[model samples]
Target: MTEFLGSVWWMIVSLGLLVTIHEFGHYWVARRCGIKVLRFSVGFGKPLWSRRDRHGTEFAIAAIPLGGYVKMLDEREVEVHPHERGQAFNHKTVWQRIAVVAAGPLANLLLCMLLLWAMFVIGKQDYSATVGRATGMAQAAGLQGGERIVSVDGRSVATVGEASMALTAAAMDRHDVTLQVVDAQERQHQRVLPLSQLPAGFDERRVAPLAGINWQFWLQPALVDRLVDDSAVRGVLQPGDLIVAVDGERIDAADQVYPAVQALGKRGGPGMIDLLRGGERLALEVTPRQGLDGNRQPVWQLGIGFSESHAPAYDTVLKYGAFAAVPVAIGETGRMAADSLGMMRRIVTGSASLQNVSGPVTIARVANVSAQRGLDWFLQFLALLSLSLCIINLLPIPVLDGGHLLYYLIELVKGSPLSERAMAAGQFVGLALLAGLMGLAFYNDILGLVTR
Candidate 1:
């Protein structure tokens, strides 16, 4: 229950920050354009906290953290006073109104770029796609284990994340995928493998499949970074002691240790844990406690934290100087943008599933996990999330920035605003569409939780 509440808290914080920033953009731009803003709200529904500034704009924090809005004075409303008509939003020039509408998404994009820049400047470690091992079963015939995949089809991959994405793109079509791999002996090999059968309840709309062989690299094991009183890990494993194995199985890599420990069931007591100290292996008992991953899967945990000193064998380290990171950050931002646009195109073409859409739950889990990892990881994730937010808001859907932009474009061409009845109809359609999309996203979230 504590962990669940913690997750909810993190979700609220993340959503609140992003939505506030987004709304601030509109508020700031509207004020700059000599428009009379009535209310600048963070979140939606009834305001939980509000203050009226000297300028007469109500600054508020609403109940729902899902989104926010900037309400402005408009003469189109029946309650508009004659004295306030000059400051109405509808009195603004078409360009000024467009600027106000465009500011929100632009702010999100800028925020993303800044976050990306900060992440690169601070330096975050990432694992390269250098393959360590690839197990061969009858399902994965014609591919040898331990071959490093350099590229899929013709696209060169530098990191594991990129490789995974490439595979997902290729997997959309039911076809054999070609891979370029380097063996341990330094020999490069080209191999073609057929796609494996997918699992049941696998929502293609929600997730893409791997196009090529999925490989795993070794990660450093979790060590005791911090200990809480009465926690299972503190009573068993101490700081400076390396976790060597769980359930008598040899812990070859850090990635395997956690799952191994989690897999151990209680036999009327705490499960046995093997540890390695200064060249000595010791046995200790630890009770497995339930924990949740980003996907909210129930896993066993000893309740200890890990330090950053343990470097895994498969890590291909790259260090960047502060000044040198600028170009890298720019390139990364561009790549992220391109990737996002490509995914959207794929989805529209029916090559990608609509299940790719993630709601607030997924976002929060991702943010929390990234925060746990490190500041750099968290910032990078935030940058990506910001970009996603910007792009999504810019989509030409009603009740969004893109929708308003479309309306402005029509006004520009027609030399007049859209009729009030037409605008109302558009709003109705837009609201319905937004509601339907939200429902689908929430449904997908529930389905994900159930399956996991």
Candidate 2:
């Protein structure tokens, strides 16, 4: 029950805050354009909290926190007083109307930039970009594990995050990506990853395991199979965990784990092992059980089995000053926005899975996990969610801010507003599209719950 409530709380806070940011963008822009703002709401449904400001705008916090709206006085929706006729939203120039509608999404993007700036200024862990192994196309390209990648497609990639962006962009663009790497023996090689033959729906992440490319370089080749019931690591470690770091030392290969484990157990009251499951990294402390060895000497062990495949982990931390962070954040936001748009385009073109759509349940789950990870991670998560919200709202579908802009564009080009009946039809079609999207999102969330 506590866990459930925490998830719900995070979801509400995250979604509510994001929606408020979006609505405020519209409200601020509308007011600046001299429109009579009737209401500024932070949610939908019944108003839980309401207050009319001195400016005549009714500020509200509504029951449903999933979305919000800005209600501007429009002659079509309400009878306008003679004195207020000039301030009616419908009376505004088409360009002004377009700006008002577009502001909400633009606000979201701006918010993402700010959030990212904060993240970069504060910093989160950082790691060098190194290859773990190769699968599928990577193997065909002669890429090997343990190589430190120097660059991708002429872009210097000092970190896995940077490498990932370049790789994904190249793969999605259907272009061969050139990788300059120094192999384990310090021998330099150039590998051309043929992206033309890359699977349609495979994103950078999904391509990793199959392509034997571990950009994060945190995966250990030996997979943890299980723990004995009475073992020291029984509860601390789980099956399928990939050992990341043993004690305080990072392991670059499976063979390196033995020396670290032995050194830690020799003088340690407790042995620390950092592990990765899915995308989450965890640290566990265990006291190895001592037993007689072949020479009748005592040997300490953590009762676990290993498998052939590797377990992966990732960590990064790059900090900058306020001024320095701004450009980096903007660049990061642009790349993420491009990635989000590309993913959407892929889905629309039937080149991507609709199952990628995430809804409330998925958001709640991620929010909870990220919150548990601490503030830096949670803030980063929020930024990404904000970016996604911005992108989705900007999609040219009716009933959305983008839809209003689309209508306004037509009005500007045609020199007249669309007929009321035609506008109503557009709204209905927009609602239908949104409903279908929501239904699909919910279905995907439920399916994820069942499968995960």
Candidate 3:
């Protein structure tokens, strides 16, 4: 119950701020365009807090906090005095009207830049591209421990997070992807992973596993964080022991340690384990025990968990001076927007899964997760989400800013506004299309939960 309520609260906060910023854009632009705004509302339904501005705009926070609006004086909606007619939104020139309509999404995009700049200044510590071990795909691709993965699908990635993002994108679009890697001897080569071999209806967690990649930056001396009671080897190994090697192979990263153990375990039972405790090197004879995965496949397993703890020598926090953060933020935002748009285009063209469409449930979960991570992470999440929202709003669909701009465009070409009946018909169609989109997103969310 607490978890559910936390998600709801996070959703409300996230949506409320974004909606206010979006609506304020319209309100600000409308006023500047000489349009009289009847109301500048931060939410819908009954007014929770209301005030009238000196300029006669009613400002309010309404009961529902999911969305908001800038209610402008339109001749079609209200009778205007002859002298006041000039201040009506309908009296604005076509270009002026288009600008007013476009401002909402534009504001979101701008907000993303600012948020990212703040986040960059605050900084974050992420893992680099060194692996401790390899299994499944990594092993099959002959990726030994300690190899540095340079790129995914030809796109350079400096961090493990970047590689994961690139690989995730590739996984959704095709049956295979190429990873450019540098081995221990500093030799460069490409490894091709066939994600297509996975079962149909592939979900989020399955992608990397099926593609044979589990990455870890920290080397083999991983201190045990926890051992699940259900794990067969839980009591065989105690926490805080530094695992330096598995069997005869020297293990630096956890990635290198895994394949060596799993393969040996398949031969029957545990293998020789070499570990360091209290600065003393020791050897313990052990074997990998037979275990079942989620699919009930019998596999050799080690019941060990690793938590985020820097090995002083391996990782560093990245902080940017305020002066340096702005350009970095702009560059990152631009790249993110471009990548997102490209992915959307692929989805539209049926090259990607429609299951990617997520509803409020997924967003709420993401919001909760990000908020839990840290302020910098939450801010970055907000920036990415706001940018995506900006693009989504700019899509040319009725009842949206993009739809209004489309009408303004037609007005420019025709020398008059669209006929009322035609505008009404467009709005009707737009609402239907929006309903369908919502339905699809909700269905996808529910389907994901059920499958899990």
For this target, which candidate reaches the highest lDDT against the unseen true structure? 2
In the range 93-145, model 2's lDDT, one tens digit per residue, is: 88898889888888888899988889888886546777775657888898877
What are the per-residue Cα lDDT tens digits for candidate 1 across 391-434?
98998887889998999999999999999898888889999999
Model 2 clash pairs are 124-317, 125-316, 125-317, 126-316, 126-317, 133-212, 134-212, 135-211, 135-212
Better of 1 and 3 by TM-score: 3
TM for candidate 2 is: 0.76
For model 1, the stretches where C-alpha displacement exceeds 4 angstroms are 135-156, 173-214, 218-319
Candidate 2 backbone clash number: 9
